[model samples]
Target: MIAGVGLCAAAAAATPDSANAVVNIYRAELADGSVRFASQRLDPGYVLYLPGERVAATSDRTRAGTSAAQAVLEPDVLRLAHRHGVDSVLVLAVIEVESRFRAQALSPKGAFGPMQLMPDTARRYGIAERAGPVQNIDAGIRYLKDLLARHEGNEALALASYNAGSGAVLRHGQRIPPYRETLLYVAAVLARAQVIRNLGQP
Candidate 1:
């Protein structure tokens, strides 16, 4: 059976939002019937202790013009993005990639709402209802602003941190981690943001 002895101890000493601070944790069963934990998969012996959230697959729906749902939410996105000092188009891009404007969308990892925020992240940002559009977008833009600040306003690094957590970025020498999902996520959001910029906002 799997054990979380080390994981529990680590969690106990970590900040409440530590799960969102790191990307993944690996666990390896040693030859001595013991376990070792690491931030990355150092070798074949290690498996993901905490798996990262799967990036939502991209599709035409994500690239299409504003939908009825998106239109309904644009006002809040604009207002909150401005309030948080984030680009409205970038916020829209993230929403498009994350949930296609579906406020009720829920990921397999339990990230919910248009922003697809994990529960801990939502609570950390004082979001009582992850499915509420205004609250979700507000919290999301705020979080993005914080990430941008953490990375010194490097949009790519901020987006990468948003996808894979800041610890992953730091462990990789302040660069985007090599995880395929995170790479695609950063590219997708930036690409979508550019497209929105060209299209002159929804």
Candidate 2:
């Protein structure tokens, strides 16, 4: 049986809502056949076992503006990045450029949530609720991790792929795509990432 009682409690505490509030639950079957549960899918092994019955009402901070929303979501960003083996600063940068930390952000192209994930990308990662903060960041970070791996840790190429599609990267001789928007996007994310990293310094 899945020994998830403690894990479930931990998951609930990690969310923005009250500890008693309903939260999404995910299950992972370990190699030894044991099962684990978490509020967020920390890795590809975990799958959503139960969607939360009620979504948390938008917090006032989230509604105020980008900085406020970013402050509210930063913990999740850091946690998910650490769990998924991606740079937290890089994740923050992506979120800033994509949706400016707005949980319910919807792009003109139909990308949803803080990470601005396209529907196909969200579905590929088993994320049915793209507007949920934890779900969106989890899916986005995992996708970023895959892109980083595919590009051999070359963030530029990975970011370009994130913006223009991996096929575009491949078609362009595995270089950053030459599209103006993609070029600007890659530059902006990298610069923002550096800014975040520098902020931690003396």
Candidate 3:
């Protein structure tokens, strides 16, 4: 009976957002696979973070590239990302890192489209075979939701899962892998997202 009580206490301590000190208000996991107590928030409608690639700082130019991903689809992707609290800044950063806004970009690993989603993963998110910027982004967000759930709403663990695959994360049990490429990818996107958070877009 004593052992059961102690185990329950331990589980509660490992949950995300213990005291809500973190400003972001989103859940994240640590590198050791333990659930984080911090919270982060995602604001998808923040137009700056979702701005188009190559868009100028000026008002007129901003709208030039804005339509690249299709205005209609942009809102849906942003809405879903926000609803999932996945951080729109993170999404934009990933898009920049993965395809640089090139919807047709293809990687050797068979990742295709703007978000560079794998074929099997894309199918899971209902993404079509053809490359569509909005669809790709939407599917990427869906995949993120699944990863976040796997990590108990922990964003960092989910992110690592995205880069390394859920199987890898499962094998490690929420801990970040020692793989260099995956490490670099997560760090790069985080840094970029931080910049967006700080700068409020150009």
Candidate 4:
């Protein structure tokens, strides 16, 4: 009985949001056959520590030459964004506005990860490990790419769908939903995306 109580206490202490918790940053062989990282801590896995990728800045230009993924992006995020055919700036923008780069962030609405993907969104992208930063970002980028295509390149509409759902956007005549949270989310992402682009300029 005492041992059982001790195990329960240890499990509670190891939850992701616990400050000072240690996490695995690289892949390692577990006791099982698969390679994995320690998921018990918030800061585990490949950290996307982008200081300048915040949602506060100015200026920008239209898409030209290669996409933003090919133009300027952080090494890891750039690779994932390119794989999904998404603009790097847009991905960073979404992360900034969603979870501010906090890998363990969880919304009250049950969205998880830096991209704040809901459970269904994660499942749709075959991402069972929503707590893993790389997997979460990859799935979110893929979903964002699809949203952009579905909305005919209307970034605002795409963002609205991300925040409020595709059905909500479609029901509103393919326009941004009237919800205050969705409206603010779209504007914030756009502003942050422009900032990311401007900072990359020479």
Candidate 5:
């Protein structure tokens, strides 16, 4: 059964069931590690909840034929975002707009690794120094969480910071700044996020 090999490949990469994902959020420390005190597997929009904001995500490579990428990443991201009180729906939208789910994609602006951080920003976020998918994802998650915190939980402002940096957002007085790319980026992320949030694919 030569066809069976293809099936096995697909099955191996199949996304975990949202209802069955082992989801948890932990408080991580650079020195002492971290632990999860609260956890759950069920939350509406745990698959995608579009918070009203925009940010440029990478291309859609991640969501390509691989098929299972969203299923795998969405639930994990949602759980972590929920832990930090971040809206998973909005985050998924941003990811869709930004990376198109392309994990290994690189941006022209010197953003590297997944989540597409500029080399300098990646270093600051503790990614450039590390070499692994988990490290890259952790760095992105932590940085996004920090942005959410800085903007008083306003997803739009936080997304602006993610696009243009915190200094720019602060200079603009906690508003989504006027940078055209960032502005359009935010709008697209918000819209697509809404799409996936409503889709709620397993």
Candidate 6:
């Protein structure tokens, strides 16, 4: 099980109305094809993606652990990144730095999932289910694609926007913010991406 009981409680406390209540706990498939429970406070502007047709049955979670799951996840993330017109290496780097491929990872700042998506960021991308690995990864990459477009294909500025808010980047004259966290995030992602590319993970 994922460590989400606490998150569910936090979300339930945040919204009292059943209609608008945040889902604190939910089940989603992990990269290893196992279902795990997760919890996070749902941000406004996101609604569930209820498919019209019934979906096929999901896979059981393999006990082979993180490495096996990551092996599955990397190619999936790379495919999604390509579909979104973003570099697969960049997405891989972000995943490494953000949550180290842990689909259920959550930050103290309330960023949740492998891509460490802030609540507002997830909402903006229409990610109804933040706990699911595939949904979360797709949402993050879609956001990254938009950021890249906004920054005229400049990876550094795009990464800065991803770390800090785009508003912050614009306020700083459309440059990477000087904040230490954002700067380090940009550098680390770039460096890691170079390493991945060097190893021919493309």
What's the lDDT for residue 135 in model 2? Answer: 94
Candidate of highest lDDT: 2
Q: lDDT per prediction?
A: 0.66, 0.67, 0.53, 0.58, 0.49, 0.62
TM accuracy, model 4: 0.63
Best by TM-score: 1
Q: After superposing candidate 2 on the true structure, give the runs of residues whose Cα lies further than 4 Å from its correct spot.
A: 1-66, 129-131
Error of 6 at 136 (Å): 0.3
User: Which stretches of model 6 miss by more than 4 angstroms?
Assistant: 1-66
A best-first ranking of the candidates according to their TM-score comes to: 1, 2, 6, 4, 3, 5
Query: What value does the lDDT take at residue 31 in candidate 4?
Result: 40
TM-score to true structure, per model: 0.67, 0.66, 0.61, 0.63, 0.60, 0.66
Per-residue lDDT tens digits of candidate 1, residues 1-202? 1122223223321222221232344566656443445445667887864334333434432434568998798888988888777878788878876777888877656777888787888999998754587898888899999998997877778877887788999999988776655654555556566555444554
lDDT tens digits, residues 1-202, model 2?
A: 1123224333323321231233455556666533455556778887864445433334232321238888789889988999999988789878876766879876656778888888999999999854588899999999999999998887877888888899999998988766655654565465455444434510
lDDT of 5 by residue, 1-202 (tens): 0000111111211121211111121111122211111112133312222232333343452322224666667666666667766666666655554554556645555554446666777788755633454455566777888887876666666766777788887787766666555554444444454445444522
* RMSD versus native structure for model 2: 18.4
Instruction: Give the higher-TM-score candidate: 4 or 6.
Output: 6
In order of lDDT, best first, we have: 2, 1, 6, 4, 3, 5
In the range 30-107, model 4's lDDT, one tens digit per residue, is: 242222222122234323222223333334533222344323334566789888788887787687657656677676
Q: After superposition, how far is residue 71 of candidate 4 from its true place, in Å?
A: 18
On a 0 to 1 TM-score scale, where does candidate 2 land against the true structure? 0.66
Q: Report the lDDT tens digits of candidate 3 across residue range 1-202.
A: 0001111222222223331111211223334322221111223311222221222244332333344544444565567688766767667767655655666767666787767788988888877778577778888887877777778877566666777787886787666665544544554455445445444532
